[model samples]
Target: MNRIAAPELDIRASADEAAPPLERPMRITILQGAFLPVPALMGGAVEKVWHEMGRQFAAAGHTVTHVSRSHPSLPAEEVVDGVRYLRVPGSDTPRSLAWLKVLDLFYTLRARKALPAADILVTNTFWAPLLLAGARHLGALVVSVQRMPKGQMRWYRKAACWHTVSSAVRDAILAEVPGTEEKIRVIPNPLPESQGSGDDGRLGAKEKVLLYAGRLHPEKGIELFLDALRVEAVRSVLVREGWRIEIVGPWSAAEGGGGESWMDRLRKHAEGLSVTFTGPVHDPALLRDYYQRAAIFVYPSLARTGETFGVAPLEAMAQGAVPVVSDLECFRDFIRDGVNGRIVRVEGESGVADLAEVLQKLMVDADERTRLAQAALAVRTSHAPERVAAMFLKDFALLSTLAVKVSH
Candidate 1:
């Protein structure tokens, strides 16, 4: 990789001796690929993390800047919640294919020219760690956050460190690039606490309700969710008990959705079933309410994106809802079968049958639900954003310091 040379600076001697500041905060910049930041609450999990983490880093006294796709409604540059937002090209378009990485390549080159000097340059982009490797040579500690298991070691060779979202991703990366393990760290996504739930870890003032919140992509497994509901035993309980299965998300192509046609297809399949598609609740408060009310939460995502670390189930867990997810290695990073939540096997002879059976169990037995829900609530504090942010800052600072020492 070609290294970018740092600019030469002229130092002048001063007559008076002055003491340096006791504490200096790190200057951090996050490249959010093509995700929007401001007025981008509904979809795009990548942007959601940048917005939240940017604010937390800024609040912790670090100077933070976020570079993401720009919106016409949002300004080209502005400060929100202490983080400075810098808009780059590619807002008019969303959900483009891998070819769009060409745009990302150009964007990184453009950002390198204009972005202020930083101690840390963090990116969630798959090829960015390698694409923007020159930033590391310029004295910025380049960190790649592996949100999915998609690429090889070449993509991460120049990164100061790779923050894997789960152990599955960490192992996958190590399998291909065993030499990078020393520079890899596993950090789970941060969770914001749920509101409106009572002290006893109980749910809303209603009956049995099932909930699903995420993108309406095929990999997300909305069809599987509807299929599980087709089982006679599961269907009987939902119909007889007057329960509702609510699917909440932004299923439009612009918001990284599977497009309206696919959503329409899902609705057709859900016909005659007590299913409600409350398409993409933008308000965080309203989303939390849905989590708090739903007694059973199901996420059967079978996407080929490696179905990396998920944030939806943890949010539902915080709201005291029992989560029933497909057997994804990402969920296993935290969820324990019949403990904090239940994981259904989706590969065997009775895949759908097992899911339906688990849903029926949660619906019929309140004690098991209570036990899991309470344990779910108990984990919220440990994964709180504040604690997660502190861990992130510590890891970030340590890596940056090490880079500076090596350069010296």
Candidate 2:
């Protein structure tokens, strides 16, 4: 296996005046499902978190290698943002295919074999827990970055340390995997500095657009958003006010167990409505444009399965869009009601009306929207990547010590 190592930097202590002595940089291998250097198919928060983590680890005197499934359109291997990337070919089918599953398993095993010697192994999701276990068997310290409260607790217990994106997620993991509380650590999602010019001040003239920018599946609450729009009052307001609904995401029938036929059904239902389906926006700059023009950011996530942490609202908030999200446990952590954004109770169709009311208020009242926008900006600045990177470094150092003790 060819080994590519970036030069190591000195790790400095904040209070010390002198440069810290150089130490051997720890080699870390991060296993992720899908790495989206291209924007279109990067569906969840985990993509951004893991990507940033790898970059930060590399910068902080560590050789970080990230392994994930490669898109059919892209090369099998490429380096981006100063981090080493190894892409394994896999199917993009929405539904699970036996052959694809086998390929994923085969590639993960292959990745374990081909990667450089690593002092630590970090697995992002439950699907890759088995791979982490394999890494542990290789005598590497295993760290599981738990993003959801699924049935992977037993497997994750074998990890030397578990890092969660939010406290709510940590609590959920504890509930499911009792006696593993000591192993869990909470680190919130990091927001990158805003690089684009947002909203061109032409608010009223622009169509009153409501934006939903993740997967168009039921779990993401797209169906709920659509169903809510179908209410008499909701429909009346949108039609009367000339508001348009825009669904910007990768839509496929396989995504929600319904093949392309499912996408056709969604489109058919949205015929008369002022809704434009812009398949997928891969470019961050273009996606930011959608966020800026959007009157309200709605994330009405319904499916409880793997709906752990939401990074979309944070990104939208960074662009100064008020988020109207479902009362999911993950959203409850960052979204404070009437502070930065509004949260509607998740109770089927009723939740939609609650979100609709908030959207309606934001549309008409400029002052309220402006206040929320400023608050959103404040939230975004607080979650800046440099600050988040520092926090992760500190936590990783602490965990590294604890992990060594546990291993001993």
- On lDDT, the leading prediction is 1
Q: List, residue by residue over 1-408, the lDDT tens digit for candidate 2.
A: 111121232222243322122264666777765333322354545666677777867766677777766776666677766677877654454354555466566656666555565666676634556655545433344454545665567676656667777666787778888888887777667763433333345333334788888777756777667877886767887877877888888766433233466678888878777888898675677887898788678888875656676778888877777888877777766677677677777565456677666666666676787776666665544565655666666655655556567568
Q: Return the TM-score for candidate 1, rounded to 2 decimals.
A: 0.88
Candidates in order have lDDT scores of 0.72, 0.65
What C-alpha RMSD separates each model from the true structure?
Answer: 10.4, 8.7
Collision pairs in model 2: 40-282, 253-258, 253-259
Cα-based lDDT at residue 324, candidate 1: 85
lDDT of model 1 at position 136:
58
Candidate 1 local distance difference test against the native:
0.72
Tell how far residue 353 is off in model 1, in angstroms.
0.5
Model 1 lDDT per residue over 249-308, tens place: 988887778898988898999998988888888677898889878898899878535667
Give lDDT: candidate 1, residue 257.
81
